[model samples]
Target: MLLIAGLQWIVGPLIEYASPSLHYKYYMYVEQTQYMGFVVPAFGIFVLFVLVLIKKTALFNFQLGRLENYSNYGLVIFIIGVFFDVFGGFLPGALGFVGFILSNFKFVGAIILYYSQSKKLKKIFYVAILYLLITSISKALFHDFILWSVFFYMFWSLKNKPSIPVILTTIIAGALLALTLQTVKSAFRAEVWNDYSGNKIELFIGLMIDSVLASDTDVSQIDGDGVDSNVRLNQGWIISATLDHIPSNQNYFNGATIKDAIFASILPRFLNPNKTKAGGQENFRKFTGLELSQGTSMGISIVGEAYGNFAHVGGILFMGIWGFFLGKVWLFLYNQIRKNILIIAFIPLIFLQVIKAETELVVVLNHLVKSLIVVFLFIWFAKKYLKWDFNK
Candidate 1:
């Protein structure tokens, strides 16, 4: 939570301010100084809730079960996930969610591999991690890698107490990698999307290496189509844009979207024909008065949405509540892990998309509610039918 929020809201802005080109490019509408006032406090309030609500004692300490069956089960789950991804479009929405949950089976499988005690499983872990890296590169999407980092850090930290130097080195390395990917992904994506004849993975690797080697040169400043991918890190712009546009040109949402998100979470599209759609372009335009291009999709972050709905004080309060709720959910799941070790697998799946700061409340809530349902149903089924002792 702290890492993502700090990077998007804090570190990105500082980098932008340091670079005249980046500042001029992204801060044309709202100045960085003006937006930081809103972004910093909002982050502070949310982080306070997280810190106050989370129990340090419950942070780690998970029980172990047999690794052989667990690793095999993860592999099977991963293969099923692949099947769903390949064909889920043909299935109905309710059935298709299975694909959504399992879409990143590589991550899930990697998590399983991380927990496995056997040294023999290390080879499989490498395979799963490599598959994750290649597929993320080929698709030009690095969000999975971020989530994988979170999973790795959390599980690893639970076991070992790494020194500060190691932690700082990891953070610096990750920052550089993120910057390199942000710099090159625009071009890499164009090739893959446009059906480049050459090998896509090789193209991605070449682009990344070139971007890294040329880090000192200004020639690498070019992003495709004149759009800065650094904006991916500067979600504060949209939030600031929302504050600028809302309640003057447009009235407050008054919780209409939050209500919509709740309805979307409970009612599948089959049941609720008018359920909120996934892309969030509609909400974005309605709230921010900015129409995205046909293929473009962006969300007013939870802070933006909260303020848009309830003004400054209400929005900040709502953020606090949201943070507290998230912390409670984290604690609740770990508690359940005591009863059923299988819940271990579902932890990352549930929080996968929820941790993102750029998505709307609708996406966050919908994923959370549905993931909980999936987790509970799987736990019940395993206890009643599978009869393979998870408690073992």
Candidate 2:
């Protein structure tokens, strides 16, 4: 998944500069600031090392098979989430936000619940893919589809099959998608989304296919938004950009961003109306000298903001902590799944946000907390009314 995120900025420079017709945005950054190129890959290698080392620390070890008594709670939760994905799209503002978060959790829950039951799991997975695909089309953003793929990978990981066919196929498909992602996003930006309301399910399916194969011959100008758009949604550029932009411009954040994220996690914006929008969006203009246009964002990476606030060493430390957090949470999630599948759904829901390297710390953390709260509230209702009593 991290590899998928890094593809554009990683290989994009080479393809663009080598080809006469291609003009990747990162080309300039690569040509001028060559050293920054190593930051993300090196950081990734470091993270892998940290994770591997942490395993040798003799902390978490488990010998377990599939759950003997699988609960139907995952199915119920998944169904409710589907309701949100379909009807909740019509809801607006906070209501809509709540709807999607609540409804969107099936992907996480599906992992454990459906793993031992592949026949049912595949059905739910398809429904989920359909839901995410249509949503991605409507928004002209491909992150939803990207997310589904992650869930899909996790689903497959449970089996740990004998053959490596799935792995090989995914690699090929991912490479194809990475190569053509920009073109499809460009097409959607210019052509697919304008009369979007009238488009059919088949149309969306076709266009999504076109996105991977470069089936649409029309040239597109990607202006860098969302997953499929003209920008690299997740990449090392944010880290490099912060390294280059800050101190060079002498506009350091001075720990303000981290403070904002912590605060934002506690105080909901709706409750505190005048609250300064914490997160990296506010820093976008300051760092990049580019205003976030409507339907577009200069997505700030969390580690980037970490770097922006505390410089390189601090950012590396932040990644170590981040990796540790994920490792612990994942272990906790598996443990909780062993205990109760329903309520602890928050385990996977929160943990999966690790893949979302595009958002700032505040945005990601705030979203996680809110989602956890939502899940908690839902569990409360379930215990009181449904009498599940899923406390662990």
Candidate 3:
């Protein structure tokens, strides 16, 4: 999965570059800011390393029988999640209705399911590609329910454990590495290393390479406020906003103002739906006090809101905490599901926000916590009803 993810990250720029004519308009809107260009690649590498480490860690080494049992429970949870998504999308006020059901029921139910039993690499890749294509096309075609169903299908695919082929894995890793290099080359061509340009990409990569590297003060001078006339609202701008808001000076739990914190918690949910509001540009400027135009800037502004609310430490803490809790839910589900069949159902739900450009820490955390409670409750019920014991 890490290899695939890395390749995807790398492939993104290549896809954009190879079809530059097609992607030019999109590229103009994306900032690919030096700081974020650096941070994203670094973060991806860090995540990959962590995943590898976890796989090697003895703590996760459950016996084969135990692992199979966990997979069984996860299957059940996946089924329940599918039903919730379906009914929530079709029924009137379904989100609210689902919320009520969840509150009353006190179980997370199944999310999307995964098909971990598959052993063929070709089959898995084809399935993944097909899933992405269908979801993407469906989202483009049908605006609501069909799109939601796409997520259910996506998550189901993600959870499935397939025996990835060595050749495919190599291809994915090589592709990702190539993409990262291309991104770096593009950054250089754009003269990102220059002093006035912030040189954030160079600095971030440098830091990742050598943790003790010190960045020049000029890097900080890049105007974070959207008021700078020279700053074009693009992908770079969005990346800058996310990076700028990291609260490096204080602890995540202790270091934010009431207003900043409030905005951090609420903005992601507000902008989750991609539809533009009337006079949205003016409204955004007024709300954020940043002179951003619509397009990806709006999405990046959401990241800015998070940073403005909590800073760097806060952002990491928020994501880390989210990852931890979500990880736990995943572990519990893995323990309970019947077949490895339901793993893929949750992937879409997990990655839905990937392209959104905002990282609303508070909203994500709140939703995740609620989800954990429900999942735990569901597990409890399953265990009791099935008369299963944890200690084998």
- Per-model TM values vs. the true structure: 0.89, 0.75, 0.42
Top-scoring candidate (lDDT) = 1
Better of 1 and 3 by TM-score: 1
lDDT against the true structure, per candidate, is 0.73, 0.57, 0.37
How large an RMSD does model 2 have? 4.9
lDDT of 3 at 56: 32
- Estimate the TM-score for candidate 1: 0.89
Q: Model 1, 131: alpha-carbon shift in Å?
A: 1.3
Return the lDDT, model 3, position 191: 43
Evaluate residue 148 in candidate 3 and report its C-alpha lDDT on the 0 to 100 scale. Answer: 43
What's the count of clashing pairs in each model shown? Answer: 0, 2, 56
Question: Across residues 185-274, which tens digit of lDDT does each residue of candidate 3 receive?
Answer: 323333432433454444435533332232434222322221211122133333443343333332222323323334533444345443
Candidate 1 accuracy as lDDT: 0.73
lDDT of 2 by residue, 1-392 (tens): 34533553444334433442333333233242443444454457546744674464345432212421333666777777767867887876646557868777677556445544557654665666666777776677776687666656654554565357877887788756755655556556555556655565555456556554443333232322323332343354454555667768756787887787777677766775654454345777665544566645555666667677776676666766666665665555556555655433355466445556566677677767777678768877887899765442
